[model samples]
Target chain A: MMRNLFERTGEKTLGFLQRLGRASIFLFHVLKGFPIVLTRPKLLLDSLYSVGVLSLLIIVFSALFVGMVISLLGYVTLVDFGAEQSLGVLVALSILRELAPVLTALLYSGRAGSALTAEIGLMKATEQLASIEMMAIDPIRRVITPRFVAGIIAVPLLTLMFMVVGIYSGYLIGHGWLGVDEGSFWAQMQSKVQWNYDILNGLLKGFIFGIAVNWIALFEGYDAVPTSEGVARATTRSVVYSALIVLALDFILTSIMFVEV
Target chain B: MTQAYIEIKDLTFARGQRQIFDGINLEIPQGAITAVMGPSGCGKTTLLRHIGGQLQADSGSVSVAGVQMNGLSRSELFALRKQMGMLFQSGALLTDLNVFENVAFPVREHYQFDESMVRDIVLMKLEIVGLRGAAQLMPSELSGGMARRVALARAIVLDPALMMYDEPFTGLDPITLGNIVTLIRSLSKSLGITSILVSHDINESLSIADYLCVLAEGKVVAQGPVEVVKATASPWLKQFLTGSTEGPVDFHYPATSRANDFHLEAKS
Candidate 1:
């Protein structure tokens, strides 16, 4: 049993290593396919529609709810310290530097990342990628790079949208409903939220999260074992892995961006 | 004998634990439709992929147009692939693209063809496959036969010197099968495209293939002109040709007797 256990563990480790190698190669090809991304405007536009435009409604709603909840909670917490007027400061700092980027990515992973995996995984299973290869067109350039570029551009824009909706919803709750002073809310937000340090870092986190999410998604899809079951599992893995990586990366980025240096 | 366009020498391949091809050697003549026939999982599709450079053979060589396939660079392999085209068993059309764009894909990707030129060329290829009327249809909307025809149109649109069809006639109605066979024959002849067809459908292959190679147990057990392969009395050939279940190709799985499998106590 010990021997069998070792053998199984070894096999899984080797499989993981091999997949890591393939994923690296796939990523390199995608990066190398930058030329194609620039040259093929139609591909990028089409992917933008699918990845960004299609995902608009969900991003909007999730942002609004998250905004409302944060403000309501902030109001409750601040009231105890006689700091309810500081609700705007608290909400802006949390949403701009942390919640907005991370949550938008998590949602995008569920929405666009899984869709990417399913679409490309099905294409792999049906040999559409191979068909493109047999046509002498690089599938990296022809299929993947545009989607990668679109995702990179889309997620950050979506995050910006999320932040806007979240802030407004916070206003509706904190100022309109909770009877917090509207002047104090906007004033604290404007004064406390540093544009360069806070907002820029948030957008930067969104950018990085975009890369990490789509990278995992596209890799899983392209490396899907080319079966129906394999594609389905890959789609599931794409969401799971992208979410995990985005959250982990968000923590790392938060540390770096918020550091004194 | 015609000159060989594709030459495989002492090729060997394996799928994980099981060896699929062992020292298989065959030559396909230029401009002739060569059919590789065997039962399912006999490396027919694998052989096509090997020639297409999608899979690397473990040993020996696969050369098309005198280009060694083993160590070619990515761009070189793609250059080699540009001279060849393959029709997969499932048609493998891009689901997102309609028939016209599917046919136009290769031309659009490889060349700077203008919209008018792209449209004209795509329409012509579709017309050749009798799918011009289906240009607006997506792959999902196409019937199996129509999808295959569209795939064929796509494969030939680039005018590759070599055309490979992997089971082009599987799961088709007889009329559709006949149409495919006629199309394969007529297309190969008119376009001077060397063709390799991997299939189990004996009637369709025999009716269309110019040369024949029959594989069994991971090797080419019989190969010659169609007439010669027909006359050859090799047991493997006979088993394959006659579709017999219980000859050299065993009907039973390689397992113990039913009594032993069931753990019978005694045979009273």
Candidate 2:
């Protein structure tokens, strides 16, 4: 049993190494296709539409609900402590620092990232990549680069939307519904929130999350074994990895930014 | 004799531990159709991959139009590939792109021609494949044969010197296959382009192939002009051509085989 366990561990390690190698190869192709992003503006624009415009409703709804719930909870607790005015500040910081970008990434990973992986995975399975190479169209440029660029551009914009809807919903809950004065809410926000730092951190998290989601999705799609089961596995793996990496990076960034010295 | 447009010398390929091709030497003469036919897993697709530079040979060289394909950079290979076109088995048309965009893909990717030029060329190529009216339709909207024609149109859009078709007749109705075979012949003749077809459709391939190569067990079991290959006395070739189950190609499972064991277990 011990020997079997060690052998299983060794096999798992080798599998991870193989995946890492395939990821690097895919990354090379993606970087090589950067010129395509500039040249194929239509493809990039269409991808932006798919990744951003299509995702707007879901991101907005998720943010609104999350922010509303958090603010409502915070208001109840703070009112009991006679510190109800801190709800605005608490909601703003939560949305900007954590909820907006991470949750938005999770949603993007499920919708856009999984779709991207499935699309590319099917292409790979069907030998479209080989066909592209035969036609002298670099698959990296023609297929991956546009999607990558679109993801990078779209994720941040989606995160911005998430932050906006989240803050608006939080304000609605804390001020209009809960009867906290609008003056104290804005004052609390102004006193506690640093726009530059908060926005920068949000954007940074958005950018990193975008890269992680795209990289994982593209890598899974590109290296997917050419079978129905392989495609299913790749799609699942892309979503799971993207979500995990987004949450992990959120924690790392938060710790670096807010941890007490 | 016309110069051989694509010359593959001693080409060998291995996928993981499996050797797909070994010391396979073949040449595609300019302005003719050369067909590589074999049973499934006999490395016909791998050979096409080598010729298209999609798969690097384990050993040997692939030279296309006097350009050595072995050491060429990806960009250089891309340039060579731009001069060639490939039709995949499933047609491999991008589902997201409409027929017009799929046909226009190559022209737009490699060249800096204006939209009008690209549009004119795309339309011309589509017309050649008799798919001009189907330009706006998505690949999913087209029938299998129509999709293959669109793929062929996309392949030839750039006016490539060499066109490679991988299993062009697979899964097509008889009428569609006949049309495709005629298209393969006429396109190569009309454009003065070299064509290489890798297929399992032996009879159709024999009818269209100026030169025929039969591969088995990673080696060419028979090769030459169609008549010569037809006249050859190889048991594998005979069995394959006649679709016979009684010869060297065995379909029956042995009693002691793992497949047999699995079947018995499933039955029980």
Which candidate leads in DockQ? 1
lDDT of 2 by residue, A79-113 (tens): 99899888889899989988888998999999899
Clashing residue pairs in candidate 2 are: none
Over the true interface residues, superposed, what is the Cα RMSD of model 2? Answer: 1.0
Which residue runs does candidate 2 get wrong by more than 4 Å? B1-3, B257-268
Model 1, global lDDT: 0.92
Which candidate leads in lDDT?
1
C-alpha positional error of residue B138 in candidate 2 after TM-score superposition, expressed in Å: 1.4
In Å, residue B213's CA in model 1 sits off its true spot by 0.4
Q: Which stretches of candidate 1 lie over 4 Å from their true place?
A: A1-7, A259-261, B258-268
Q: Count the backbone clashes (under 3 Å) in each candidate.
A: 0, 0
Across all candidates, the chain A TM-score values are 0.96, 0.96
In model 1, residue pairs whose N, Cα or C atoms come closer than 3 Å (at least 3 residues apart or on different chains), thus clashing, are none
**Error at B38, model 2, angstroms:** 1.5
Q: Which CAPRI level is candidate 2? A: high
